[model samples]
Target: MLGQTAQLRYDFPFLVRTDSLSFRNVSLADAILFTLTVTLAWFISSSVCQYFRLRHFDGPLLAKISNLWLFSSVNSGRSYLDFWQVTQKYGTIARVGLNDLVTDDPAFVKHMCNVKTEYRRSSWYDGMRFNPTSNNCLSTRDEIAHSALRSKMAAGYVGRDVDNIEPKIDSNIRDFMRLLGSYADKKTPVDLGRKVQYFTLDVISDLAYGAPFGFVETDTDVYEYIQTTEKNLPMVMVVTVFPWLLTLLNSPVLKGLLPSTKDRLGFGRIMSIAKDVAAERFKLDVNDARDMLASFIRHGLTPTEAESEILLQIAAGSDTTASAIRSTMLQMCSNHDILHKLRREIASADIAGDIISDNEARKLPYLQAVIKEGLRIFPPIAGLMSKEVPPHGDTWNGVFIPGGTRVGYSIWAITRREDIWGADALEFRPERWLNNSPEKVKEMESTLDLIFSYGRWLCLGRTIALIELNKILVEVCS
Candidate 1:
């Protein structure tokens, strides 16, 4: 026992010494190093996340606390309800994503849409190439390319040359009216929106491609193309969010995986049909049916260039007008009082027998109001039409938005601003436009409320759309 105690004392001291060494008090440097490691990890993790969040902008919830504030904005529904909610919270210069910036202020809009070279078409526009060759008119985003196409496009869309297409408009309108009897008789809850879509599709298709796909035939065989286009939206949005994946695989299979795949295929097929028509048109004697494609071809477009231009014409010419018509009917349905009043105004007009001949109907206050209101409420294509802010960046409402940031304009946000229009901003009051004093309208013209876009980049289809719209209204009213 004495021997064991002696050994225990020796070992016990050693053991205590070992424990004392291992559990030695932490030095100030040790604590500092530990804290520094943690802080570095946090910063690294946050920076990576911020980069990816901006890169893959499919609406991440983590954006609310991000430094850039883009995550706090744009993280909502694709619908107008969600858009307006965000705008209210974030103000006119709302951040939609880590890189997305939505501005509704007219001054900001003027700068983005009108100021040349400062804001270029976003990468998203490039991502929307339907065919191998890009078209001349709508898809040409740069000022120089746009300018080259616009001169010819303007001739076809506006002036006396376009005015001569009135008969076609009248005939199309008459066909629509003749079909309306069926709606009245059965009192069927006509998907007038869909029907109007068919009518516009057929009209534009016939004029642009030299053949309609029987969308407005007595057989009611329209809407196949529209259905295909509808299926493609999600695919496009998906591809936009993940452009790298698509760029890697340029195969049909890759494109098919896009959220807008259905739309791409659907529209691609229509463009194929358009190409077939162009093949035929290319061989024919050059006549006066300049449906934008012909304009491009006659002016300078070669066979290859013509193919691309024709496809673009077919897609843009039909889809935008169809979008406008659908929105117009929706507005008309929601406000039947406005609908009835517009109809009365139309009925009151003297058409001079030719439905498309007179500007007298266009001079009517209510019809113009309805068209403008519809565009304001539903500006057809939603989502940010991205712009690349110049290297110097952009300024909005006097605030500096950094360059290299992806910029966008929200139709849903802009049209619903209370600051510009007043308390009833959400309400569909045509009187704001139609009943305003003449001098006020002249001021508005100087400021120019451009729902169709502003500056040199405005839609080339405006004149045709307006004329056809007037003819349709006159036919319905008269």
Candidate 2:
């Protein structure tokens, strides 16, 4: 009798068999309503489960449910400051996104960025790639590949090699000074930020490719590369929080959806330039070594490999050094004492040149202190440095972060914390770095150097960047 009833119900469309085994014809609207009710219940249950899964960590309720809050926060143009505020409101170890946690504690920062860390960089870095398919040291998510690449490229960035590249930097510095002097003579208000950016661009380009883009010589961004870089960064941050959006950003088939021509190019001109330089370097005689490109070729890198590394160097080296230079200049201009003292130190060093060498600049303790202070007060890459927790997960600072979770610390937030840096942490005091005992100086150095980064992934271009920054300051102050 039950089989007969089920078969009869199946024969009729939209027929419902009740618990009492009575068959009834159901309207289309009723069926639709019933399906909707079940779907709504499932969705609610799933959301509740997801919320409970991460209930151990504290965060804004909206953030715990959707990445929309994180995306909105980043798009607000003050993501770093906003995330820092999250800590104040929710305490350290706050969940800033559905699957991301941010902590301001230095120990946790150290653990996340350790040289031989179990934690690997998060996919946020994937948004940094010029090409999604090509892997470079900066954008590679694979631990093994990154290490291998870093080892291969290490020779080019060693102190001695960077020193070897200094003459190229010096030549560009001379042109930069000449341009600035022209502005001074004219008494024209110079955009020092743009000038330093052009200077750094020319220097890094020359070192990377045996030629500059002529930004310093031209006294302008000839290719508007700096503009391109600035435009992409906000988008990069957006993708870091909403990685699902990477497809629209990077996919050629979805090119129409991209917001700008710059996005579509994705460093096209720069990559082409790198490739051309690599090709030229590859054809060089074994005895005719030139620059960083030669070093890459010598280390058995293919033309493509050389281009990738050169692109990384130029992109990483230029903007950051420019930021440091601009920040230092602004701080000095605002604080006359710092400017005068730095000038006095440069004069006393007896540096005999229109452009000071890095070694000579290093001798000026006051100048060094000012540079360190600027780096501390205004880190170039002040955003989050995210690392993914290992598959096994780990506990940090008494909080158990689950496996596959993204965690990071903001250099901007960490450096400005009053608890760590004292009540006057907000002050732009270069003197803080000087007149301290050896122990105090060591601790300060440790804190300041963290800006470059920590452990195995420490910036490869740090030496060259320091050279450019120190030399530029000595020249400007003198």
lDDT of 2 by residue, 282-328 (tens): 77773447456666666677777777777777777788898899988
True-structure lDDT of candidate 2: 0.77
Residue pairs that clash (backbone atoms under 3 angstroms), model 2: 115-456
lDDT tens readout by residue for model 1, 1-478? 6566556657654332332333335568777887899999997687676456444333334443353333222232253455456666766666555556565566666677774547877655654555633545554567687687677556656643443366666666667776777778888666676777777877776556655666666636444567766665555554443445446556676645433323334665676666676777678666665454565556665665566655555556667677777777777777788888988887776667756464775788777777777666666656566677888865655666677677666667777766555578778777788667787656444343465677766766677777777667656544
Which ranges in model 1 have alpha carbons more than 4 Å from their true place? 1-61, 64-80, 115-117, 132-136, 159-164, 183-189, 218-223, 252-265, 287-292, 354-358, 442-449
Best by TM-score: 2
Candidate 1 backbone collisions, by pair: 74-96, 232-260, 232-263, 234-259, 235-258, 235-259, 235-260, 236-259, 236-260
Candidate 2 positional error at 359, Å: 1.7
Which candidate number maximizes lDDT? 2
Residue 130 in candidate 2 has what lDDT?
58
- Cα lDDT for residue 205, model 2? 82
Where does candidate 1 have its weakest 10-residue lDDT segment? 68-77
